[model samples]
Target chain A: MEAILKVEDINVYYGSIHAIKGVSFEVNEGEIVTLIGANGAGKSTTLNTISGLLHSKTGSVTFMGENLGKIPCHKIVSKGLALVPEGRRVFLQMTVQENLEMGAFTQGGKTLDDDLERVYEQFPRLKERMKQVAGTLSGGEQQMLAMGRALMSHPKLLMLDEPSMGLAPILVEQIFDIIQELHKAGTTILLVEQNAQAALSVADRGYVLETGKVVTTGTGHELLESPAIKKAYLGG
Target chain B: MEFLSYLISGVSLGSVYAIIALGYTMVYGIAKMLNFAHGDIIMVGGYISFCAMSYLGLPGWLATLLAMAVCTVLGIVIEGLAYKPLRSAPSLAVLITAIGVSYFLQNSALLIWKAAPKVYQPVVSGSLTLFGGQLSVPYASVLTMAACLVIMAALTLFISKSKMGKAMRACSEDKGAAQLMGINVNATISTTFAIGSALAAVAGVLLCTSYPTLQPTTGSMPGIKAFTAAVFGGIGSIPGAFLGGLLLGVIEAMAKAYISTNLANSIVFAVLIVVLLVKPAGLLGKYVPEKV
Candidate 1:
């Protein structure tokens, strides 16, 4: 499989604090890759750097062989990479459908009927509440809306951070189910999650991150069986 | 009969304020900043109208159109140079910069146009009889009301039906996410300022004709009043601002006629305070739930 996104020795800093230190990873086309980490472990920073929200001090980020350095977030999005940022940051004042419509803002006036129908098919709950304001939705619903909004962009690469955060156990299952559905639909996913066991269940490959660096990388089944992963992340 | 004439005057006056309030509300709704220079934009519009009419010898209608055009361009320039640089700065910094811009523009006008007030000639400065009551509405006043109504209608349509309007609203709700959706955040902000400043120009032109006198600092009181109107109506709601302005104008007029004229401002502000205390979000402010 060809690499759709390649991050090589990327260094990102926030003022004096270095967040991502020479992080290197490759997300191949049509694969689900999970990055698991503890808090302040530089998971979000790596995603931010790739999405053009934060500039890297060193190293190169290539999406489909095009360099992503110094590109604005909007322009980066136009190239078919969408980030469903942490905390389900749906536009609260807009309706659920409007939030989805906004996902297509980069598409200009292109046909969105298929994208809209696909999103509705993925999250039926969102379709029922399409007219409701996003801020009024439950935490899990908002998460679904956030994912639904990103999918509306018809992105080639969907990078999600903590989509199950604060979600009910049932809703978390639903979110993960949607992630699997997205992968099956041929969208490449780069997922970041603290729920290592659940993420590893669906992820084809897994990278365990500790303190701003990749500590281990292997096949999902291998990491799931590893004693270190079991002791630190998956409780016996 | 006197009361009826006052009603007409109040409605016309309120409409102008409402137009100005729309600019404030639109920008505040999206940027969550007051754009303090909004009032000065109105002053700039008036000066532009004066120059077009008196200096360039353009007719009244042509001058008004020219004023709107010039002020629109000026608005885009201000956003590009002033507000754009401070986009990521703290809200206070932006607020102070806006105030500074307002003062700078006003002082520049004073220096160039002189401190003396200029009155744009009234296109209709006559009396009309309606329902056995004689009322006088300056042609400028009628024109102002007509212009405001048309603009308000157009803006309402744009916001409700246009793609750019939806983008603006979405950006207002969540700028970061809007950018992720491929919306040009900078361009949206600039467009918001441009539309707002253009509305201010219309108000400026109308006001000069109605009052027949203008000064460099003419926009301050109106600016404050329109800001108050924006707050009184929900800050983010276009229709709310218009309603609030009309309500404020009528209340002020009634207080002046029936109550004490000196107490009009106090009464209006007191009403605003009472409304805010009851509902901090204003009349049309919707409740948004925070993350649990």
Candidate 2:
């Protein structure tokens, strides 16, 4: 009952293939929940369904106790859910500032600039390159820009899909630090990652996805300590 | 003095083509479809204004506005009915659909108005003398050029400064990413169609004013020319369309004056082929490598 987002027994299909089967999870308010999985384990698919980019074949996605069925992808964002997609699909031709402005497209008035300022403060690197075109930025900078752009919408529930997919080790640490800062600032997050180590380090709870199903779930620490997770994901 | 007159008329003609090309480029930008029917919308606009002023006795300003309104609705309707359903279809199918719509509009206009050329008086009749009559440019030519500039200026500001404009740009960059930001991709696309169609109407009305004749087939040649301009400038680029239109116009005028009128279109197409061979991305278009 206390969960801000509840995914109950959802099944998603891509064409004739079953992409996700009977998957369920809960994200409570003010908690960072991570979904750690190997490639082709349907990690991105699960997040895409929740973000309304992909439709579920069965079951329900309830956000704040409201069913998010048949809602268009854009409407889902206006409902205070933002997805920082994989590959950091920022508008490459636009300047950093313009990309941020697009995040607040649903808003009617003055708050857009204010929201942009808030985002800039959170990601100062974004502030420095506000006028730089997004494509010209490095891979890590583009990832930060993607996260910052999503934050500009003042989303109640933020979803990050593989935020550290291609960053250097140092940059990955910086990215995780920013994520921890966001969590501390009370932003509820649903994180999807193949980098189980960094994801579990900051996550309050974790779910292990394999073959399109949740095989195990626990506190971040418990998953880190588990022998199976250590052998498979943590490279122990 | 004679050279200045030719330059003025060429510019005036080029402005009309630019307006039409703007429609093609804009539709292609947001929807990624060629919108071949766009040129025909200009024909409809010309006929609408012709009917309103000639048949209904409305004033020219009111008639032109009516034409604009009708064309805007028609554009939206075509997008909603014809293009929206095929959003996910392959590019070839959509292209064929656009060509079909173009033919349908042309034939329907023929059935309603016949093929007879209707004489259209320039909105502001007669030529205006400039530089002590050393260059006598028609008022219609001056008006057409001014209108083109105003529209271009307004469009530039809108794309750069407005929220919806920003959304359109975002969609052009990546539709899925734009949707993640809460932009309704379908709605943005519809708005783009509306704007493009309105510009088509402007071009149609102005073209008729300069030439003072309207027929069901009037838009065909100009439509092809404008499309060539779009390709010449770079299909998805705004400034590219403008530059392409102006250059094509000047080239056409030069070919007619110095060479033969029969060779004008050939020269224009030859320039397109040469430019494309030299720079396939168009003059102002950036080479965007597809992200793997």
Candidate 3:
């Protein structure tokens, strides 16, 4: 499989504290790669660094054969990399449709309209609540909206951070099912999750990160059966 | 008839305050800081147009356009020089810099244009009597009110419909998320300041024409009053600024006519204190819930 996105030996610091230290990872063109870690393990930080919200001090992020060094966040988005941020940070003041429209901000009118239709088709709940303010939506709905908004940009790579962070178990299952559906429909994903059990189930490749360093790398099935991972993460 | 005239004057004054308040609300919305220099920009704009009209003998509308152009460029330069570098600094620091810039502007104008008042040509002159010749409204007042409405309506539509408007809204909501959505947050903020300053230029020109005098401190009282209107209406909300300005104008005018003229300022301020005590978020402001 061809690597679509690559992060090699990247280090990120927030003030004096090192957040992501010498981390390296890659996502193949048609794969769901999950990054599993404990609390304060820098899972979200890694995603943020990739999306250009936070700059990395060292190393390179080559996306689709282009080096994304020192590029501003907006310019990075224009290159077809989208991050569905942690906590589902939808524009609370805007309507669901407006939030989706903003996803297509860099695109032309014709592309934007087409992408809006595509987003509505995938998340019909968003369609029903199109005119409703996003902040008023439930947590699960906002997460869907976040994903739908990112999809509006037609990203070649979608990175999701803690998509199931605050939700009922049933909602978590539904979200994972959507992830599976998207993966089957040929979208590359980089998922960061504290929910190890569900994340491993859908991911093709998995990396266990501890304290900002990649500790183990394997196929999803191998990581799921590993005793150490099972004990620390799955509570088996 | 006497009461009707006061109301007419109030509406006209309110319109000026409303346009000025829009600048304050918008700058606060995107930049998250008070552009204290904003009010002074109005004075500078007024002076610029006055010069163009008096010395160069430019037409009325052309002078207004030139003022707007100068103010827009000046706003960009001010933001780039004074505000941009200190963006991540403490809010108090940025605020003090703004005050410093405000004083710098006033002093510069005093030095250059002198403290003496200059006669201003009314953009629209003459008065028309109404309601059996008891109530009369000046054409300048009518023009001021019409310009204010047109601008307010156009801005509201721009924000609600335009892509850049959505980008501005997004930046105000979450800077990081906005950037992640392919929005140049800094650019959005700069555009917000430019628009706000452009409106200030319009407000300045119309305000001077209404009063028919240009002084170094012409914008001081009206600027402060407009700021009060922004706070009264809910600082970041667009319609709040409009409503607050109009209401403040009416309230101030009514107080002057009905109550003691010396006590009008006191009465207007007292109303603000009462409103703030009851609703700390202002009339239309959203109550920001603490996330943590």
User: Which lDDT tens digits does candidate 1 get at residues B30-144?
Assistant: 8889988898888888888888888888887788788888888988898898888898899999999899989999999999889988876653466555665566655555776
Evaluate fnat for each of the predicted models and list the values in order: 0.88, 0.94, 0.85
Model 2 alpha-carbon miss at residue A161, Å? 0.4
| Cα-based TM-score, every candidate | 0.95, 0.98, 0.98
Write the residue-wise lDDT of candidate 2 on A1-236 in tens digits.
27999998888888888989999999999999999999988999998999898999889999998899778888998888899999999999999999988887777757977888898898888899999989899999999999998988888899999999988999999999999999888889999999999999899999999989999999999999999999999999
Worst 10 residues of 3 chain A by lDDT: A107-116
lDDT of each: 0.87, 0.91, 0.91
- Cα lDDT tens digits, model 1, A1-236, are 99999999998888999888889999999999999989999999999889987889899999999999968888988898999999988888778888888888777656677888888988899999989988789999888888888887778999999988988888889889989988998999999999998899999999999888999999889999999999989985
What residue pairs are clashing in model 2?
Answer: none
DockQ: which candidate is best? 2
Q: How well is candidate 3 docked (DockQ)?
A: 0.89
Model 2 lDDT per residue over B51-150, tens place: 9889998888888889899999999999999999999999999999999999999999999999888988567777888787777878899899999999
lDDT ranking, high to low? 3, 2, 1
lDDT tens per residue, model 3, B113-179: 9999999876678898887787889988899889989999999999999988888999999999998
